[model samples]
Target: MTIIATLIVLGVLIFVHELGHFMAARSVGIRVDRFSIGLGPRVWGFRRGDTEYVLSAIPLGGYVKMGGMDDQVMERIEGGAVAEEEDGAAGEGKVQPGRGSADASRTEAVPSAAGRRRDSDFDSKPVWARAWVISAGVIMNMIFAFFAYTAVAAGWGSAQADTTRLGQVVVSFLPEGTEELEGVPEGAHFTRIGDRAVEHWGEVREAILDAPAGPLTFQWDNPRGEITVPMPADAEERRRVVMGLRYWVEPELIFVEPGAPAHRAGVRAGDVVVAVAGERVHLWSQVQDLIRASPGREMEVVVARNGEELSFSVTPSSVDGITPDGEPQTIGQIGVQAQNPPITYTRVAPLEAVQVGWSETVFVTGFILNFLGDLVTGQVSTRNLGSIVTIGEASGQAAAEGLPVFLSFMALFSINLAILNLLPIPILDGGHLVFLGIEAIRGRPVSAEQRMRWSQVGFFILLGIMALALGNDFLRLFGL
Candidate 1:
């Protein structure tokens, strides 16, 4: 199921990208020879006017082939324009946009009809037009992402952390030695952190972490008292300090998979898990710890639904899952999802959604660039890189979760594709843009031999990157 979902996502992204080039080419009078949705041999295609649209066998990537894109005729042409018309007399005229090269002398070796080749060739078009044709794919990807994100935001609302009240507060245990845990209560409930009024744990945590070292103020509800504690000034100390304090959250069930233990035991969404195996659980993590420790045991479960507390016997299923650090671990599973209390969502107006969408698109674009910079600086590991396999897994998982999640996943990938294509690498849209920029400045395109050499280098670099990404994917799949 994951594989199929991934393929559908990839296929849609590729089709959208290629469609951009095809539409822009026709609009600008460039003759497109073929528009393929995938690479390798054509599985099926139908000719329409001047272009043949095809579905190729390999679903990895796709391309748009335009008329007169071949190297032979491109090299023979001088000054990047053809003034001669079909009448065989040299006349001053703008190169016709429909064909790649219209001059009979330049395209004689090409087998296309003399009428079709005249003024319709791609190379014959102006440099600006050519650049637009090359950049159309990236533009299309970004537009798709923006619209998709807006629709998801408007339809499902965005997920946000509930931060109105504290769930629980616990002692810090870090650095293998500490004395700060002595004064703190075992389960301190907090209402406010510093001067910030926090309704959600997320807000409180952020406030506390952002506070200047010195002394941090806190207001507790259960104890009905205010306290000021010394806060760590050092970055490492702050990290450990944040980890020492655990926030409280109600383990409210959000999703229950069919045929799973929770569903079989009559558990339903909206049920707040109160106890497991006779042990009261205030936080979701506590529930998880108990369940994982006693996998396969028939345990008594209590959930608060509506105004009544219901009880049931559930035998958890043992499943292979990954830990937070990416290590393989066997864990208990009831096929349920939990969230903190006060899950608030707002139905944003259409215009607001668009604004949010644009902002998100910009964020994703910047994130990709920053990630690439980290990769170059060795701040990030190559193992973090993902290939098609990882994409398939993620997309499939999102699809299984729900429509809104799946759409958001697609939007993210759309942004990624746009940014990646715009990179100034050879064999990409960005590389072609570079050539067009040089042409615009020099008043002529680069020599065919030079372009080909740079393209070859780009191809090898792309191949090496793909190989490394694939290696990472394999390692992850095998749990290495």
Candidate 2:
């Protein structure tokens, strides 16, 4: 299921990218010979007019082949416009060629039709037009990412930390294992941590962690009312006090396992797990800890349903798993999903979703660029790269976790794909554009030999990256 889902997601991204190029080429009057989704042997395709649309067996990547353009035609087209034609000879009411007028006229007349056809070809288009055509694929990708992110943002409210100043007392999160508090929520806001006016969650956390033996005063606001809660005298006793609780900050759920413990426990879509076993479990780790400690034990589960607290008796199923700390443990599991709280719609307007999406797209692009930069600078190990296998395992893990996570994964993967295709490597849209830019500047097409050599290098580099990514995936899957 995970593999299928991953492939589908990847396929959609690839299609969008290729569609961009196809559309751009058509817009510029360039004939596309073929537009294929996926690579290798053609599984299915049909010729429509002058173009063949195909879906290949291997669903990895895709491409667009243009007519009369060897991908470097942009330079030729732009430079050809400014080319000087030989002077014609003076004749009676007729334009004549220069010194070798007779010979030149004979040569030109022979290939007049062919020359006209070539002049109207893709390479004969203006440099800017050619550049636009080549760049349309990446532009479309960015636009798609923006829309996807916008839809998610508009559908689900955004999550904001409780940093808004409502009064003199600010709410903040109190860290776990603080001797001053009992069980404050992980992201609770507070006014004072043992006599200090706390503004940020980090400040509150630090104060609690560094507290000497004393009662901690936390002024906070709850859905019911605002109140000040005193921490326990023993600092060690109240380490995990979270003060300001935020709910439903993440968006919708994307996956749900059939017949899992959650399925049997009456947990359904759009339900938020407000509390587990009567303890506030805002984060997955908190819920995980409770389940780990109470495997096969029935506990009270409180869910937020349409702004109401609904109760259920949920039993954690026993499962063999490894904790984040790397300890092998048999733990309780419920095949249920918790709703990701949508960002507060009031905080951001519907149109702003586009901005959010664009921001996310830019962020992901920068992240990939940085990663590549790190690879070059030796800041990050190249061996840590990933391939399809790694992506599949990641998808599997997200599916196993729940729906909200899977949605997030899709978002990230979409952004990643969009950014990767923009790299200036031959055979990629970016690579083609790079060559076009050089040709436009050089006033001549790059030699076919030079283009082929650079393309080979780019292909090998891409292959190397894929191999590393696959290796990383295997290592992660087997816990190497």
Candidate 3:
């Protein structure tokens, strides 16, 4: 399934990119000899007029072949014209049908302008037109990315942190273990921390962290009631208090493994873990910590089911799992998964998709560029770079998890593909555009030797990056 999805995504991206070049070439009156999807041996193909369309065996990358684009090939194709012979034979029939002198006279006639135009046509096109023809592929990829992003944003909505202010007190997703003594519930409006009003989560955390050791007071209100809790006497102990609450964000419970702690404790799909071990549970991290701390220990679990408060005792069990840093650890297992928040779609007028799509396309392009820059500068690690194998693994994991996750993964991969193909290097659309730019400025195309040298360098650089990405993938996959 992962392989299929990856191929489909890559194929669509590549096709859109190639289509850009094809369309631009046709628009500029440049002849395209072939437009191929994929590479290597043709699985299926057909010639239509002057162009041959092909679906190749390898489902990775594609290309467009244009007439007069290659000097040597164009020369051969143009010089091999049998038109003079045919025209001579026709003319000879009028003079003397079977005479050798008739044929000799016909062979001496000048070649038509049409034949010469066909041979030198593409090279004769304006530099600007040629540049556009070469650059169309990258432009199309950008356009595709924009549409895909807009579709996802409009369909699924965007994820953003809540930035609303009420007072000095801020609402939390889950109560910290130390904050548990404060008796704050999830969704509780914190009005004041000690003497200061809390306006944001950051402020709330700061106040908590900087609180005076003795009897720190918190003023809050929940749907049921308002209350205040006092901090402990020990300043160090108070610092250890974990406010496990998260800001209010909609998320679904998507999966529950059979016989797992969550299942055994009667936690089912659609049940929200409102609080765990009396801590307001906001994100997965808080829930995970609670489970990890109480492995094999029974604790009170509070869940919100269809607007009803339900309480159950769950005994967290130890399970073997790999950490993000590639360390094996025994962590508490609940065998539960969360669903992505539901997306609210707003249908727009047809024209809006274009504007929205364009903005999204530019944003994605910029984002990819920034990310690569960061990676190169060591601001981000090489581990963040993923190969096709890593993408497939992610897809498989998401698929095993649920539909929302899978869809999200697909969106990310699509954006990544669009960005990666737009890099200004030889063997890419950007590289071709660079050559075109040189031609436009110099009034002549780049020499084959220069292009070949640059292409070789580009290939080596690309191979190195691929190797690093694949190594990262292997390390992640096998928990190395």
Enumerate clash totals for all models, in the order shown. Answer: 20, 43, 22
Q: lDDT of all predictions, in order shown?
A: 0.69, 0.57, 0.58
Q: Model 3, stretches more than 4 Å misplaced?
A: 70-124, 151-185, 189-221, 224-282, 287-338, 342-359, 393-415
**Ranking, TM-score, top scorer first:** 1, 3, 2
TM-score of each: 0.63, 0.56, 0.57
Instruction: Name the best candidate (by lDDT).
Output: 1
lDDT of 1 by residue, 1-480 (tens): 888889889999998888888788888887766677776555787877766677766787777766666432222221122223687542222233332221111111132344344466677778778777778888899999988888887886654455444443334333233344345554565677787876655566567678886777777665666677777767666566556565556689877755668888899999999999999987887888788866677898899999999999988876554443335556776767786455444567888888878888888888888777766766566767888877987888789867877887888898888888877776678877887788789987777677767766766777898899999777544434
Per-residue C-alpha lDDT of model 2 across residues 154-248, encoded as one tens digit per residue = 76644343352222111334433232333444344456656676655445555656665545455654421233444545543344343323321
Q: In model 1, which runs have C-alpha deviations exceeding 4 angstroms?
A: 71-117, 162-344
Best by TM-score: 1
Model 2 earns a TM-score of 0.56
Worst 10 residues of 2 by lDDT: 99-108
For candidate 3, write residues 130-186 as lDDT tens digits.
667766776776666666656655564442323212221122322233444334555
Angstrom error at residue 222, model 1: 4.9
Better of 1 and 3 by TM-score: 1
